[model samples]
Target: MQRELIDGVPVLWAETPGPLEATLVFGCGVRDETFRTLGVTHLVEHLAMSTLPRLHFDHNASVDLALTQFTCTGRPEQVADFLERVCSALCALPLERIEREAGVLEAEGSGVADPTTAELLSIRYGTAGVGLASFGGPGPDRIPVEAVQDTVARFFHAQNAALVLTGAPPAGLRLPLPAGERPARATGQPVRQAGPAWQQAQVPGPGLALSCDLNDQAVFLAVQLLRQRLTEAVRHREGLTYDVGGDVVFVAPGRGERTICMEAREGQEQRVTELLWQEALRLATEEAPEAELAEEVEAAREVLLDPRAVEYELMEAAAELVLGDAPMRGRARLDLIEKLTPARLREAFAAALGSALLVVPCDIEVRPRRADGTELPQFSCGQGGELPTVGESSARP
Candidate 1:
């Protein structure tokens, strides 16, 4: 990837055989908001895109867990115009449109993570940072203008943003966002339940979350192996599930939450939940077969060599810069995956299971156990303690 500075913002680009693609990425996202201010980043994205005039081009904006992006695909001039307008809008957001746009946001009530994944994050980090995903908080219509202003001031600026393109930077392209210092990186998240526990929520199926080093090749392969097992056991064999997938959520530099979510056939939630736990314990204990491990490695190889990897890698580089993670470009994940042994995979997975949180539907009843015969504890939102007498609390005198 080629790197340069455009109007004080770092620009990363590469050549690809397609329409020119340009993306403006900022460091702020849902993780930067409080419960009362949830969805504010998304609202800001909508507000910026609203300023653009109707044009026949592929352009849009989005906000995720750790970054906000405005992208466009077209001729170089069209792409340049779209980005210029977006940056101008950020410098002077039309606050009058907040109420109208809030209604639009309310009509489009969506979240970045699935319900199960969101609930697991809340269990892991309380109702802040990544945990805020589980909540809708105040209605968008109630989001104060002050919150939007503060978000832009803190995050939407030249110093806190990066741009990437599918080709070289267009001639005369500019990023006119206001000048501001980048905010401090978030680290050492507060934990609510750092454990091997289970909880019930309004989720479609069973899910599991494990905390581990984001760069751990063994854990990455273990997740892939577990997903494959769930697909075989719950979907192919029992016909109790339809979808098996997961996401690796970036929490801090070198740390993350790996989540696996399965969609079960109705009335078979219990069986699916049991199989999910069973497979997890089985992987944690037994060594994976050589054939199974080889299959995963081959899959990893395919992804690294695909044609679209260049664009993906550029986007990843911008995200790393925004999120304060060290550039992982030097480390070859595929090479590391090839060197992993079944015993190493089992050990890494077993270590991660020590910090696992499981989520099942509210109607499902379960008492899951670890491989060592100890049962995983159930999670509770409230502390278990007696309350003081109403208006007459006991005090030490």
Candidate 2:
């Protein structure tokens, strides 16, 4: 991987020796906006890429909590052309299509009910910053053209962006963006409460959800080990769930969120919750096996060495840069993973117990209580609606 500066924007290039694929990653995303203008960045993304459908290259745009990206795969020249056109389109966004795009956003929003992470975030961090994911962004109709333009000028600039190419540098690619400073990371507005709390939600099936603070490398390894243990107990042994896994999500600098989730069979919600806690307790007390840790490390190495990994890593680095974080290279990450000792992982698991949050079936009368025997908090619906019962379809918290 090589890093260069073109027109004052950082560009990361890797010669993967395959068909050309490139992505223009910007520092702006849902995290950059306020509750009043929540979906504005996404709206801008849609309008900016509206012209791509008419082009020959395969291309798309995505807006996540912390970044927006435009990606394309094609011949080098074709990819260059696509990116150039996108940069130009961003420079002068089509404000006339604001209403049209707003309709599109509304339609899109309707299809997606609240997601589990969004609900968790809302519970963890109120209805602003990261919590806006649960609240839904400001209505498109309320966002003005000037607001969109200002956001574009502030975030979609040379200093706040990076261009990553997988095959080779696209010839004659120009990022004609105006000068601007990198945008600051979003500061989440956390709810005024301590956790190790429990919450419940109504959904079609039973499931177990867990969240913990991402404090260090040990916490990350602990999350992975927890997922393995949960899968074994819930899916393989008890046959209570069909899906069981966990993921560590990047929230901000020196902070992350880990989630362990499982989908359960009908009438198995309470059992699944109990089993999950049992595993959690075991993990907290017992050390992870050396064999298991080695196996997981090898699996991670395989993923990092995969052909597609660099592209993903490059985009991740771009997002980290925007958040004022120095990205860890692949070698550094592997070294950390290699040094993960059973004792260190156990300590991390112990610390995770302090701030754990669990979500279970709302209708289940006997929910899993915290280890400390305290009452768990219930997450209310933002729309002033009643929580879903077991038989009804549940919306995200």
Candidate 3:
């Protein structure tokens, strides 16, 4: 990979097999907004794209949990034109278009994460920062014009942005975004449930979330191994689950949530939930075999070392730059993965499970347990299952 600067914005580029692809990434997304200004970042994204003329080439934009990306894949000139127009639109977004774009966004429907992961986040962080994923705060129509302007001024700027490309930077490519200092980000987010607890939520199936270091290779492998074990037990052996997967949500530097979500067949929600807990406890208590660890490590290497992953890797690097993280290259990461022993992976996973939050479907009742046979606490949003009347209630717009 090569690094350079364009109009004071950091640019990372590398050679890959594809039409020229470029992404302008900013270090802001749903996590940067509050309940009152929910969806403001996405509203900003829509307003910017609404200004572009319809073109035949592929171009689009998206806002995720912690980053917003404007991406295009076309000839060099086309890519350059797309980036320029996006930056220009962001700088001078037509306030007049806010109402129309709000309606458009309403039709589009906003969802930052899947239901299970969102519920886990809400359980972990309450109703602020990354926790807002589970909330649908006042609709897009409620996002104020002033909020949009302020969001753009604070986050959509050159210093908070990074550009990455599959090919060399296009000739004459310019990022003419407004200049501003990168805003301070939290190194450790406040926690609501530092828990080994279970709760009922509106999720498709049971999910487990463990707070851990995002960069920990052992925890990474543990998650992969857990997913594999669940798939083997819940899907193939029991035939109760249709899909089993996991996701990692970034909270701050070296801090994040590792979530395992499973979608079970109808009428098997409780069974799947029980099985999930059993497997999680087993993985936490028992050491994995060397063969299983090697299998997972090889699978990871195949995906990371594949040539087609170049663009994905570059986009990740750009996100790291925008989020104030030190980027790890594929080769370097593979080297770390190769050295992980089964004992180390098991130890890391066991430590992480100490802070596990389990969420099951609302209709299911469960009493999950830790490896030592102690029952996990049942989660409640308020004291004695009732809302607190002591705090002031603020009305929404």
Candidate 4:
């Protein structure tokens, strides 16, 4: 892998011997938009790619809390052409179809009440920054053409962007970007809360959700280990849950949230929550066995070594660069994982549990409360009732 500047835009090129894959990643997404202007970046993304001619390749665009990415995979020439077309479309977005695009966005937003990430973040951080996921995209009709165009010019630029290629750089792949500086990282105004707090979500069946501030690789490994334990105890041993897993959401540099979830059987919500917390507390008290840690380390190393992982790392590196942080190389990451001891991981797990927030099924009354005996906050929306005001009864200490 090599880094260079192409037309003033940072580019990370990897000459891997595999199918060609290229992504144009920018430092703009949900975090860049305000509450009133929410979904502007997504709207722009939709408009920017609307004009691309169909090519025999896999191409798509996605928006997250802090990054927007356009990716294509196919023959080198095909990938290169698609990327160029995407850049051109971004530079000259067609606003004439604003109404049509707005309708499309509204339809997309109407299907789901709220994304799980958004719900969890709203409970932990509130409806700002990463928490805005709880707030559906501002309808296309509400966003002005000028705001969309201005966002494009400010964030989708040469300086705030990176091009990643899995094979070789494409010939004549010029990124026609306007001059602009990278926007600053978006910050979340997290709601103040004490830990082991519980919230409710409207969903079929029951599940247990947990969130904690991400500190380091040790915490990451701890989460992975905890997930494995929960799966074994909840799904295999007890047959109480059918699916149990977790994911990490990075809100900003050195700040992230990890969620562990379990989908429970009917009438088993209380048991599932109990088992989930049992696993967390066990991990906090006892160190993970050396063999279990080794297995996780090996699995992680395999993923990092895979050729396809380069594409993921490329985007991650670009996001890290935009956030003013250096991306950890694969070897360095493995080294950190390798050196992680059971005692260290236990400490990390305990710390995570100290600040963790738990979300359970809404129908189940007499649910688990916070460890400190504080009342657990409930997340109510249009379906549940009126939304709670900030720092209201739903807010925890």
Q: Specify the highest-lDDT model's number.
A: 1
Q: In candidate 3, what residue range of length 10 has the lowest lDDT sum?
A: 184-193
Q: Model 3 residue 120 lDDT?
A: 92
| Per-model TM values vs. the true structure | 0.95, 0.87, 0.95, 0.86
Model 4 C-alpha lDDT per residue in residues 361-397, reported as the tens digit of each score: 6777645544455665554443457766777364576
RMSD per model, one decimal: 2.7, 7.4, 3.5, 5.8
lDDT of each: 0.89, 0.73, 0.88, 0.74
At residue 41, what lDDT does model 1 achieve?
95
lDDT for each residue of candidate 3 in 13-131, tens digit (9 for 90 to 100): 88988798888999998898989999999999998999999977999899988999998899999999999999999999988998998899889886898789998998878788889
Whichever of 1 and 4 has more TM-score, that candidate is 1
Candidates in descending lDDT order: 1, 3, 4, 2
Strongest candidate by TM-score? 1
Q: Over 4 Å off in model 1, which ranges?
A: 384-397
CA lDDT of 397 in candidate 3?
A: 65
Q: List ranges where model 4 is wrong by over 4 Å.
A: 110-114, 203-215, 366-397
lDDT for model 1, please.
0.89
**Tens-digit lDDT string for candidate 1 (1-397):** 8999988899999899999999899999889998899989999999988888998999989988888999989999999999999999999888989999999999998888888888888878888888887889978988899999999999999889999999988899988988899798657485766788898889999999999998888999999999999998888898897889788898888898999998888889999999999999999999999999999989888888787888888988998878887535523888798999999999999999989999999997888987888888887767668866678766799
CA shift of 387, model 3, Å: 14
